[model samples]
Target: MSFVTDHILKNPPVLLGLIAMIGLIVQRKTFAEVVKGSLTAVFGMVALTAGVNMLTGTIAPINTAVQTQLGVQVADGLSDVTFTAEYGGTVGLAMFLD
Candidate 1:
């Protein structure tokens, strides 16, 4: 599932699936009192996500300000650091496991 659509969307289906499971929990808590409660749980998640998106919008500016005001610089985002090495051995993971 991830291999096919990991790059397609920012939130990804995994997040939605998790939200749905939690939404179910919320519905169960009230014994599924009404359909509106379940729907509200889902909508609440959407609203929460929107709020987080707004908060994240300021991260860049906040980072810049902190870096500029203070002498401390912060490293953010992904990094391209990898090491490749070839080994010649029995490759011991755990002899008992094998």
Candidate 2:
């Protein structure tokens, strides 16, 4: 069961395909529609993931150059802020409230 859940349910492409299949089934779609929908969903996720990977690859060199030039200076008013206090209140409050 863990293997099935880990390999199938938790995989992005498989998860998207499963969701599409389930959605089509719930709507009583035809067999062709079910298969096409699931495959499209899976491929769509794969394409999106590829696009993001390309974007990050392109950005890496720019990020490195920027950091090299900027020399890791802190933001103007945030120089003394501890990491815990920096985002803790905003993220914590939003997490529970939202």
Candidate 3:
């Protein structure tokens, strides 16, 4: 049953539809009502996934353009060590008090 479980976990929309259908059936919903409710849930999830994909796709080009234009240089690990050396004692005391 590992194969079955793997497929079930991978497709969350299907799992959610199955759960909604089962809940509706247990509540003695009509056949039509069960089908409608389950399909609505599944389609809603699909639409949400599509919308998020489109949003991310649209933002990626903008992000790339901004990063390229900015020509920003980030300092390496030197700053992190310097910060700790300067403030480590104060931070350690604050944490001890907390």
Among these predictions, the greatest lDDT belongs to 2
lDDT string for model 1 (1-98, tens) is 33323332223233344445556665665545444454665577678767877887768688788889998975543321111011101111121124
Q: What lDDT tens digits, residue by residue, belong to model 3 across residues 1-98? A: 44434454345566668767878998999999999999998898789878887997899688778868997644556553466555544554443345
RMSD in angstroms between candidate 1 and the native structure over all alpha carbons: 11.6
Reference-based lDDT, residue 18, model 3: 70
Candidate 2: tens digits of C-alpha lDDT, residues 1-98: 54544456446677668768988998999999999999999999899989988997899688778988989743555422354235444443343244
Which is superior by TM-score, 2 or 3?
2
The number of clashing residue pairs in model 3 is 0
Rank list by lDDT: 2, 3, 1
What TM-score do all the candidates reach, one by one?
Answer: 0.39, 0.67, 0.61
Between candidates 1 and 3, the one scoring higher on lDDT is 3
Q: Local error of candidate 3 at 66, Å?
A: 4.0
User: Candidate 3, 92: how far from true, in Å?
Assistant: 41
Q: Model 2, stretches more than 4 Å misplaced? A: 73-98
RMSD per prediction, one decimal?
11.6, 9.3, 14.7
